[model samples]
Target: MSNGKVYLIPNVIADGTQEQVIPAHVLSALSGIKHFLAEDVRTARRYFSSLKLFPSIEALQFEILNKDTDPNTLHSLLAPVFEGNDIGIISEAGCPGIADPGSLAVKFAHDHGIRVMPLVGPSSLLLALMGSGLNGQRFAFHGYLPIDKHEFSKVVRELEKESRKLNQTQIFIETPYRTDATLAALVQVLQGGTLLSVSSDLTSANEFILTSTVAKWKSQPRKLGKVPAVFSLLST
Candidate 1:
């Protein structure tokens, strides 16, 4: 029997913005998938229900696939695919496998000779880079910065130095609650002329995106209010 394909599905970055951010083709592809691996089953159910794609979400089978999931158990979690049943992977937010634990499953599929198909969807990293007016051709995404103030400060300076030397954009994210602290650290550690871009609550009604120098950001500070945000920096 032929092995079923593994579909990498993307979830909305913000709540209630599926229609605005998700394309019709992605929904069309999702309609055919019944088995899923999600970081949070409850969130996945609620998201799918909001799309009104399935009459009964209960009819679908969902398996846990979060950061805590053991790699040794991946083979069993993906058993349905081996049985010729296509399985979709859904992350808590954004595209699956991009800074998400879903990458583990993708890697397993590749190693085991299973077909993997990635559907088009919203990716906060790419969106932030596109809007940052920075060097998209030469950019690096560091998933998350250190939460420790001292370590965060050190990393910020190092990244700024690297950005200046390579002329590359440095992109990273922070926990919603730490947004203000992260912004303050960046402003304080980076050079006055360094360009910093912050994209918060992307694709939402309250979406806010700004690109300015560290000096300008310090002069006119704005509160990000504990929302998901992506930060990008470029040093000249």
Candidate 2:
């Protein structure tokens, strides 16, 4: 039997409109796919409905691939594709395979010799880094920091040191509800001259992306509130 292809579908960063963040070709590709592996089934359904590209949501098959999903179940998820049915992988937000569980499915497709295609869309991390004025050529993406205050501080300092030593950019994100707390911790821990970038509510009307030194930020700090955001750092 002929194997099918796997498409990596990116999701919107914010809740405004789909057309603003998703590319036209991605929507066109989505219109033809009937199977999907998503980080959140409900969110995937909502995204599909927003596009109006698919024939019917009820007719599509969706498999959940969140943090709680077991690695053992990945084969079963790709069974349809092996049977000649093209499948799509969608995340809760942004592109899959970056701080998302959808990477597991992509890896499986690669191991099985299945073709995988990635579509263009909004990515808060990349957007933040692009506006950071930092070393985009050599950057690292550390999804989320340690939740413990002490551990988080240690990690923050280490990333700062590495950034300063190698002139490499360090990027990470925090849960929406804890954005303020994370920002406070970062501002207090990183060196005064360290450059920081914050991108929030990307692709939405209320979007904001700012880059400034830690000292300047302390003089006039802005609350991140509960909006989803991406943070990057570069030492000077």
Candidate 3:
């Protein structure tokens, strides 16, 4: 029997109108997918309802797949798909499998010979990089930095050095609560001429994306209370 395809769906990054961020094609895919592996089921329910993609939220099946999810259970998540049932994998925000636990399910699908389809949607990191005017040709996403101050500082310096030496854009994100501290660390740890880009509340009405040198950032620091943000670095 042929296996069903797995759709790696994308979600909106911030609290905003759905039509503004989610593509029509993504919604169409969601309309036909009744089973999902999501980072947060509650959020996924809310997202689907907000987008009006499905007829009945209560009828859909959802499985939680987060950082704490056991890798051993990933294969079982695809059992339905192997039974000729198409399934959707959703992230808490942005593209599934990028920085989310959805990667586990996607990997399992690949190993088991199931087809995988990625739908178009807003990715805060890529959106931030595009707006930041950073090196788009060559770049890397470091996910999250170490929370320990010393280690974080050391890694920040290394990323700066790589950006300087390779002309590669360095991208990373922090928890909303740690946004300000992360921003401060970037300015303090990077060289004066290193370019830093901070994009916050991307795709929302309050979206902000700025790129400046470490020296200028230090001179005119901006407050980024508690909000979703992406940070990028490029050394000139």
Candidate 4:
């Protein structure tokens, strides 16, 4: 029997924005997939239901695949594929396997000779970079920054220095509640001339994207509230 293919499905970055952000083709691609791996089954179900793609979500099978999932048992999670059943991987938000744990499954598929197909979708990092007016050709995404005030400042400075040396954009994300704090730290630690970009609630009605110098940011501070945000910096 032929092995089943693994489909990497993308989820909406924000609630109620699927119609705006997700492509029509993605829904069509998901029609044949009955088995799924998701970080949060409930959220995944709700998201799929919002699409109104399936008449009954109960007919689908969902397996939990999160950061806490055991690596040794990955085979079991993917056993359905070995049985010739195609499985879809859905992230809590954004594209699967970018910063999500879905990457592990993709790696396993590659190692075991299973076909892996990634569907087009919204990626906050890429969107932020594209809007930041920064060097998209040379950029790196550091998933999350240090939380400690001192450590955060130190790292921000180092990232700024590296950005200046390489002319590369440095991107990172922060907890929604910590968005303002992270912005403050960036403004305080980076040089006055360093360009900083903060993109919040991307693809949503309240979407916000701004790229400005550290000095300008400090001069006109804005509250980002507790919303998902992506931050990028470029030192000229």
Q: List the residue pairs that clash in candidate 1.
A: none
Report clashes for each candidate as comma-separated counts.
0, 0, 0, 0
Q: For candidate 2, lDDT tens digit of each residue in 168-216? A: 9999998999999998889999988999989888878888888999999
Q: Pick the winner on TM-score between candidates 2 and 4.
A: 4
Evaluated at residue 164, the lDDT of candidate 2 is 89
Better of 1 and 2 by lDDT: 1
TM per candidate comes to 0.98, 0.97, 0.97, 0.98
Alpha carbon deviation, residue 91, candidate 4 (Å): 0.4
Candidate 3 lDDT over residue span 28-58, tens digit each: 7888888999888999999888886677899
Query: Would you list the clashing residue pairs of candidate 4?
Result: none
Q: Is candidate 1 or candidate 3 better by TM-score?
A: 1
Over 4 Å off in model 3, which ranges? Answer: none
The list of candidate 4 runs beyond 4 A from truth reads none
Give lDDT per model, in order.
0.94, 0.89, 0.89, 0.94
By TM-score, the candidates rank as 4, 1, 2, 3
Task: Give the per-residue Cα lDDT of candidate 4 at 93.
Answer: 95
CA error at residue 88 for candidate 4, angstroms: 0.3
Error of 2 at 158 (Å): 0.7
